[model samples]
Target: LLEDVKTVNIGNEMAVTLSAGIGMDGLSYAQNFEFARNAIDLALGRGGDQAVVKTSASITYYGGKSQQMEKNTRVKARVKAHALEEIITGKDDVIVMGHRIGDVDSFGACVGIYRITKALEHPCHIVLNDVTTSTKPLVELFQDNDHYEKDLILSSQEALDKVSDNTVVVVVDVNKPSITECPELLHKAKTVVVFDHHRSGTEVIENATLSYVEPYASSTCEMVSEILQYIGEHVKIHPEEANAMYAGIMIDTNNFMQKTGVRTFEAAAFLRRNGADMTVIRKLFRENANEYKAKADAVSQAEIYRGAYAISVCSGEGLPSPTILGAQAANELLNIRGVKASFICTEYQNQIFVSARSIDEVNVQVIMEKLGGGGPLNIAGCQMEDVTGTEAIAIIKKTLDTMIEEGDL
Candidate 1:
């Protein structure tokens, strides 16, 4: 039904798509209607052009092959910024968090929110645990500094202890509760806000006071940069903060080469006016000798599966952050001709992390979703437990075969 819907055209120049929701086996009519509404929201949240079926037992998806359309207006950002300002002003305190094992985009977005809360003269703390190598340099700028509070960054337990009835928790870069830096804070706070660029999935942070999840935005940093412009006319961005946010936009967009649009450049220009320096960001992200070698090895040893998918394993021995290298390797594999998508697997913290990337031909997000993970169509990831790299590769291959047979690939 969805495939046929996708084939419909408008005036032979543009295609018309449909998003559907089906609910079954409900105990009451109202419950069934609620389920249907939720399913349709999920389908639209996942970038439309899909169908979601919800039952009391499970949720299923179908036909999400289309690319998400980017909005060309800044009206939504302006409205969200004003709403966020009101929420912060009403709260006694604010706590900001990103996904665990923080990256530039995640940490940068946190900093952006911190600025907002501080400008309102509301006490704010960023919850971060286990800072990886990629994020340490940026984090150090805020630690033990007179410009910011001494407890600017707190651990999960510390955040939990500090959260109060009047606190508003702002989750950035990631929307999934399970992967948040401190999921407990969500339950403790009276109000919660979410800002992310990833497509919505089955799992999400429920009952958010405000949500700004634009899959079309290049990165969460881009979205935050736009919000910063409208927060207040006097909200000044420090060079360090500008640099942090700029690094996020740079890294997530792969130096403005992927997932970038006109608004992305506009956001970067805004940061530049606030004293963002490209040279400083480049110096911060410079790779060490071992890190470079590990990434190259992963790329050199890559295996092209089915002549379209590039698969490789990044060895983590003696590496501070192997998953970062894995994601870099995945991006590098896209340069190979005839490769529709790339998947780089790395063993870290007793689990296998798979970072998937694609240019256009394949929807890597759908594949990752089937493996219990999700992101944008171009960049996605999943994690598996108790599986060897070779075993994970075989499993991925089987999934690809099944998806291909079902005409989903």
Candidate 2:
């Protein structure tokens, strides 16, 4: 099939290319489907325009050296949303969780899920703990709201203690098992569901009852908002919840400057109709003087490479939180005229945390994946133990140089 696609030539001498994944020797249909999915991902990762066949014990590949076609559609998202509704409705307890250092996108999606579970008349709990600095303001707002129930928020250990045979864990904003706030609770849960906008990582949660990973969506909250549209009109979303989701979309889209699509706007409009106040969201984004100064120092310390890549390290004291500071620094560096991609390295929690961003040309996802991290093409991150900020920057530079030389960036 790939060869036939390659053989077809238009009058102007343009040829088409296709990639195929063939699954055979499977004991069941579901097993075969899983094999095909993994095979296709592998084929695309090796650079598409190829055919990959995966059996129970062996794998074979042919012809891969072309760019993979990008799929942008909402049909699959709708289907997955319905499937997730079914999974949530059938379960007794729904526990929602996000990655470590929960951000706006993560917490917003959790609130969305909590609303959904409540609408379905199922008991739900949001597993949360310490948040990054940027999320602190939003979390405080939620806590202060009359409609928000602090009792519904559980710590990792608390959630673990309540896990039952019928409990279903819904992981949002991230699907990677290694990055979740509590992988142990996830393991103990009877079922798992994932909704994320990030690219799939190597350490994915296995056998999720429903997995919705949309790399094209601006944020997980955007995907959750779209799901809400399909979940029936009677479903109620509070003003606070709506605002949280809206704030999430705004943060991930960089205030509508990055990765904004038609669907992204549609979600925002829905939130606006639900009383997502922009004034409150602006207040949530307001940074204190010290945080602003820390961000400025990070920008001043940035090192530009090849006139396109900007790398910065937060070396000094007084930075409020390394994770939030690194992300802020990365965003700040992108404002530079010639920089196409930016990376902010910081020391946090005894690890070197690197937050990376791009203007969609550098494919930061692939770059971060090499270092055991993953996200979308424009934003990605990784954390490394036993490495100083300077050493981590050097490793990143070396990796970038190799990818650039190989024409992979």
Candidate 3:
């Protein structure tokens, strides 16, 4: 086998071929190299934490080095202040919003903005969509407070009626285009701002006027913590707001073991000082019998890919089973001693959804980005509109093989 091998020539350089029958189809070496350079996506479609290299003829594997680079507190602090300063020069009339499927993090970020905007006296409307918020108890927190505004939940037409050039829209928790969580508010806006901790995959809604996209932060609540510091004099961290943000922080960090950071702890501590109750947070995350069973089944079927990585699939008729089930499975996979990365893919509403997580050493964000999705290095996701979970798995493996071939291992 060694004697049969030959050093493959591309342009000016030569790379040894792995005998997968890779060759150009009657094309010049230069043209093929350019073609390879252009069409080959160095990342994505793999389970992540790997790379892909495609020449004219074949693709092959390299595996398992997934953590993203660690962040420095000083650098993050400076960048945060710079972003805050850019918006300080001109405060405009705006509506605060979040994804339609509201979670504790989304609601927490919205409330953080509401408090600041209320102090700024901006005419803010938080336009919620449909009955997406029907399952949340946090709604009661806002509704009970007469000071917090709550009249804007409406139809897509109603939301569209409210947008204008001066109408600045701020989206929290997620930056993806499909607002299945809040589609109406996104549709009518010309200017938008996004503050999210999740990875940004391929699907998008143009660009926001101001976007603070950081996958390193633990949660949207952490990003909101930065914003609250910016508006230091105007607002206080109320108990309810603290509880909401704390719940998000704890959930994303998996109780501070998987992806927690110094800032994460600091934010949680501040919220605790404001009187956040852990018992109430426990109540919020409690799953019904159906949800618990769905999660357990997904975890049981999980398989280890490389020695360090694990992956599983959860197929369902709707979004909740996949979304909640995927995260729960990922958390469960982490329990295995050698496993550093966990990926769960499931079918939902005509789309294939994926959720990936890693220990502090792996960057799931970089891997997810290749699949047109993004988040912090430790946790991320992607959505495939016209594919099944099985097809998605093949794409991931081939991409991994190619990444190994290219030495992005």
Candidate 4:
């Protein structure tokens, strides 16, 4: 039904799409209505153009093949920014956090939020547990520095202990609570806020005072940069802070080549005008010898499955951040001709991490969702436990075959 509805053309150059939600097994009509409301929100959050069915047991999705249209207006950003300012001003303090296994984008968004809270004259601390090799260089700039507080960054336990009733917990880069740097802080704080760019999933931070999640945005840093402008005219962005946010946009968009839009460039320009130095960010992201070799090996060993999917595995034995290498390898595999999508797997911390990427031919998010993961349509990932790399490949192949047979790919 959804596919048929999606086929309805309004004019010669355009077509209409529909999103729906169905609820079942509810005790009462009101309960079912609430369920349906949540389901519809999930459908739209996952980029619309789909149907979502929610029962007591599970949630199912259908017909989410189309890309989400970007909003040209900045009205939503302005409203969200005002709301965030109000929340921060009312709070006594703020605690900022991002997803686990911190990446450059995640930490950069944290820095942006930190700047916002400080400009509002509220105390703020960033909760970061593990800093990956890619983010260490950027993080070192603020660690133990005279310009920032000594307690600027804290561990999960310290953040949990410091969170108070009047403190506002701002989660950036990720919306899911399970993968956040500190989930316990959510329960400890009375107020919560979320700012992210990834498409939403079934799991999300509940009861957020402010939730600004834009799937069309290039990165969370881009979203935060826009919000920073609306916070106040006097809000200043230091060079290091601007560089951090700019690096995030650069990393997520693959250096402005992928997922680049007018707003994306505009956000980059905003950071640039505020003293973002591309040369410094480039130096911060320089690859070491081991990382370079590992990425090259993964690409050289890639297998083009069905002449459209490229699959490979990276042996990141000596690399400080194996998952980062795997993700980079997935991006590199897209250079191969006739490869519509790519998947690079790496064994890290007793789990198999699969990084999926594509240009436009495939919806990698759906593919990763099948394996209990979610991300944007072009870039996604999944983690598998107790599975060998070879077995993981076989499972992915079977999944591809099934999706192909069902006309889903």
Put the candidates in lDDT order, highest first. Answer: 1, 4, 2, 3
lDDT by residue for model 3 (95-214), tens: 777775565677777776666666565666665553332236666676757766556344446556777766777788877767635566666767777777764443445556777766
**lDDT per residue, candidate 1, 1-409, as tens digits?**
7778768766676567889998878899988998999999889888889989998988998888888776899999999999999999988999999998899999999999998888888999999989898999999888888899899999999999999999999999999999999888888888999999998887899999999998899999999999999997778999999999999999999889899999999999999999999988899899999999999999999999999999999998889889999999999999999999999999999999999999989999999988998899899999999999999999899999999998899
Which candidate comes out best when scored by lDDT?
A: 1
Model 1 per-residue lDDT at 35: 90
Which candidate, 1 or 3, has the higher lDDT?
1
Worst 10 residues of 2 by lDDT: 63-72
Off by over 4 Å in 2: 1-37, 41-73
> lDDT at 33 for candidate 1?
91
- Kindly give the stretch of ten consecutive residues in candidate 3 with the minimal lDDT sum: 14-23
Ranking by TM-score: 4, 1, 2, 3
Q: What TM-score would each prediction reach against the true structure?
A: 0.98, 0.86, 0.72, 0.98
Per-model lDDT: 0.92, 0.82, 0.64, 0.91
User: Residue pairs in steric clash, candidate 2?
Assistant: none
Backbone clashes under 3 angstroms, per model: 0, 0, 29, 0
The positional error of residue 238 in candidate 2, measured at the CA in angstroms, is 1.1
State residue 224's C-alpha deviation in candidate 1, in Å.
0.9
- lDDT of model 1 at position 303: 96
**Model 2 lDDT, residue 348, Cα:** 78
Give candidate 1 misplaced runs (Cα > 4 Å): none
